[model samples]
Target chain A: MKDMIMSYSDLSSSIREPWHMLLFILLSSWTLLLCVAPPATWAESDKITIYSYSSETSINNFKLLKMEFDSYLSRFGPYELQPVKKREDFERYTKGRKDCLLLISSWHFGNIGQTYSLKPALVGLRNGKKYQKRILTGRGASANVEDAKTARIASAASDLHTKEALSEIFKGKDVADRADILTVPKDIDALMSVSLGMCQYALTTEGSLEDLKQVNPFLHRSIKVVAEGRKSLLLILAFPESSGKVRENMMKLVKIVQHMPLDPDGRKKIKMFGLDGWQPFDSSDKLTKGD
Target chain B: MKHLKLTWLFCFFLIVSSAFAANRMPKVLLINSDASVSKYGEVQEAFKEDIPHPVVGVNLGDEKWDMPSVENLLYDEYPDITYCIGSKAYHIASKYIGEKDIVFSSVLNWLRLPLTRKTYGVSNELHAEMQIMLFRYIFPDVRKVTMLYSKRYTQELFKNAKDKARNMGVEIAGEAVFKGRNTISAFDRLPADTDAFWLISDPEIISDKKGLSNILKRCEKRNLPFFSYHEAFVKLGAVLILSVDNPTIGRQAAGIAKRVLSGNKPAKNVEPPAGSHIILNMRKVKAYHLKYNENALGSVNSIVE
Candidate 1:
């Protein structure tokens, strides 16, 4: 107790001057502000946040994709890649964040891009094709879509999107609700389900069928194309419509994406997302309008 | 005109012969112990994907066939290779198709299965070398790890893991508990220098949920990161998990089956699980203040936040 009283007396005695009191108050307030303020406000202001969600990549592999993307983007500035697993969460994160960029599936962008005022900046290319076709493959030799009614169809598409895509392919049959849909992890799994007699048909992409051909030719030859849907655009990198500083910052980030393929490390990173490279988004691409 | 007609006839014959040859390809009978189980179904689908020839699948879970009936069915189909998924399938198939090539997967402690020169298997558990190497990859500073095991369940596994750890400059110490009730106490008695706790697939050590919870709680109290062999343990506060990838195991089994069908013996009779599904519980990692290599996140199959 005596030591505490002496220490208090010493501190009080040292700050007896009017100038000392003003300096002490200023310093204490500054320290309090530093301790209480949210770190994001100050630390993240200069960091470029990129929110990504893709139905094509598995949830687990998305984490790896984020790591690779962040490593490549770090060369330019403070960049962070955040993986959003659900569509609702992606919408919540990117809806009002004008300063951030969204790397998402074109199907999803078509649904919400207009509502959010997002302008397509770049489109992903795979094997030199900007769009791909989804095919319904089966064992039968029929090109009619009505055969899918009441049939078990295996697909790798997200549950909601599968219904939409099926509605488009079947046109007016309402097969999405009538058909028994089995969800798998990858396109190959869906194709294999048809080959192994687990399902009546498989709703997969043309690229996946090509992959199966290379993997097992006999199984590939047995599968017949039941129907093919219209072309669907690949992944799109977009930014919100904004003005002034935010727009300037987004443009700079867009340039980085535009030149990413030229760099070896950046090319490797983009390849993790199953993309060959990036090209300027075509505003006239009808697929982006809707199904 | 005569030459053209002869060429057309020859072309027609070539097409017909190729179609006939395709029909004569060897068949494989895939006997699943239970197709109702999701993992079993996943394995079946993946196996069917890579196997080049036609596959005929029969679900033992869906059928009730007697010995004579099974024998009759085999005689009817007469598969060149028999691929069994679980222990039950392997047992029944081996009993009927004696001395033929059999490839099995998803069998626990596959060392117990009857083996022959023609038997090939994909072990259900990942190899000790792989687990330890992953541990080192994630936590380079963690030099010493401790695990509790029962003599009957994990004696050999512990010794093999310890040897593999030694080769990688990591020390793995094993504590034995004869009863499931003593699992927590055994964990409590772990050496103070233990950097981490590894939970292997030991029946006695992980027999009850309460015992497992107590061990994990003790680990938390001591600030020891828990490494487990199942994804379910992540919710129970496991910092890292290494589990077998069922689909990959199926593909691996298919590869072996293809090789054996082509008249080539596999380089090894029993191969360790090739693929591992790694799960990292970021919440537990942060709560425990564990140090892990950020670069290693690429290899993680799942993350629990």
Candidate 2:
């Protein structure tokens, strides 16, 4: 009986408004449904491909950064910032492509001559002298660095900073001559190689000693940074000439990220990654000579 | 009859979907001292999204473990299991975790935190045991090790350090730097006959305006080897610095999270930091003329004479 009454009330209400009332309810819902999060005009497809120079912090820190940068770069039409793990892979992937950016982490700063724009980001003041923060290795290895004449030292890709850092450490002795200088595919690969017996010596940026230790306590005991470079010049973002459109877009994107509200969650990632702030790559400074 | 059939089908679908959703959600809680040395930020990054459970910084430095308000807030939250990251957090959570079903990974003390055999059957507090064993392995010749801490922080860490040192044939000379303005002076007051000092940086050590440089310089002049938390202290005149990272602690803490949620016992016996990451400055070592293996110097992080 209750059902019968409800059906009659529904019939009378429908009869009062008929098609006009039915159409009004339908259209209102259609508009409400449309108010979901704005459609992503850009996605990973449109994401700008960036060369991430990374190693030990890759699993914990890099993934977070890739996510943060993904969100940051979403303002541009969609694009992917791909991280190549090694120098060999980067060379293979980035060759003939101007859209890719070159990133050499400061941990591998022994390559002082392999330039990443010698700009000072953080200074480690010790005994009235400032040294670049660097991660180190070759502490407990058969390829002993201290007095060994023939030892291979690890750094980032063959950039000016890597070349420069090695020059400073090896000093008068021809480092490239003493060691069998083998370059790994990625920044972490170089560090790992030194840690795991694939290579002997590894040098990197200043702030990353804790990161390498987190990977394995044994690795922590096995390696220690030898020399921290003079940190007067700050490392900068670099790019090739072909990355013209992408570079312009990324720098513009960085400018906006500068103003974006940083959350505690977000800052956790920024600090772990050791990014001082983003700067656009100058035309002359961004490109590196082929390794 | 048709309407009733449709309703049954709808309810069946809801049952299937809801089961998947409920099973997928994770329950996590934090046990950090405070923001000054908090690892909460990284743990959140590791597992983003608030999973129906509470995450609090229990030992905020201002509140002690026994404070009623702090205790109530702790007991009020329904943390299925707890993850204690810092020593201070471990101090407070030890009581709470003891009362409930919990699993903890990254405490310096695995033996003290209630490592029971019923935790998934036969148990071994390996991490805790490993650190002690590593200490023995690293310094086989050591006989006496002097340590210092505040009495108020409780004898938990003090006792553990003592036991670990003693088992390896080391006699401990622990000095309590009690509540007073001049704490370093208290450390200095310890018997001069003590062999070496292991300076674990604590609220007592860090809060002192009386720089440890004095204590460190004294150690250097006496040619005493200093074994400390990090190499920074070794640089400041300690013989060596041995420690690990904060995020690794977070990940290890998460591994405990898995066991607790699965109804396993909380508080597995843990070990101290291992020997693999030891730092010995050859310059400093040579100053002491300690006669360490030449192989050890090759693996040092930083060497300051």
| Predicted candidate 2 versus true structure: per-residue lDDT over A25-141, tens digit per residue | 787788886786455444453355766554322222244446555665554445344555455675566556545444544344324213432321222122222223443456554
Off by over 4 Å in 2: A1-291, B1-18, B21-136, B181-189, B263-277, B294-305
| Local error of candidate 2 at residue A22 (angstroms) | 99
Clashing pairs in 1: none
Q: Best by lDDT, which number?
A: 1
Cα displacement (angstroms), candidate 2, residue A284, comes to 54
CA RMSD (A), model 2: 24.4
Cα shift from native, residue B276, model 2 (Å) = 6.9
Best by DockQ: 1
lDDT score, residue B125, model 1?
Answer: 85
RMSD of each: 16.3, 24.4
TM-score per candidate, in order?
Answer: 0.53, 0.37
CAPRI class of candidate 2: incorrect
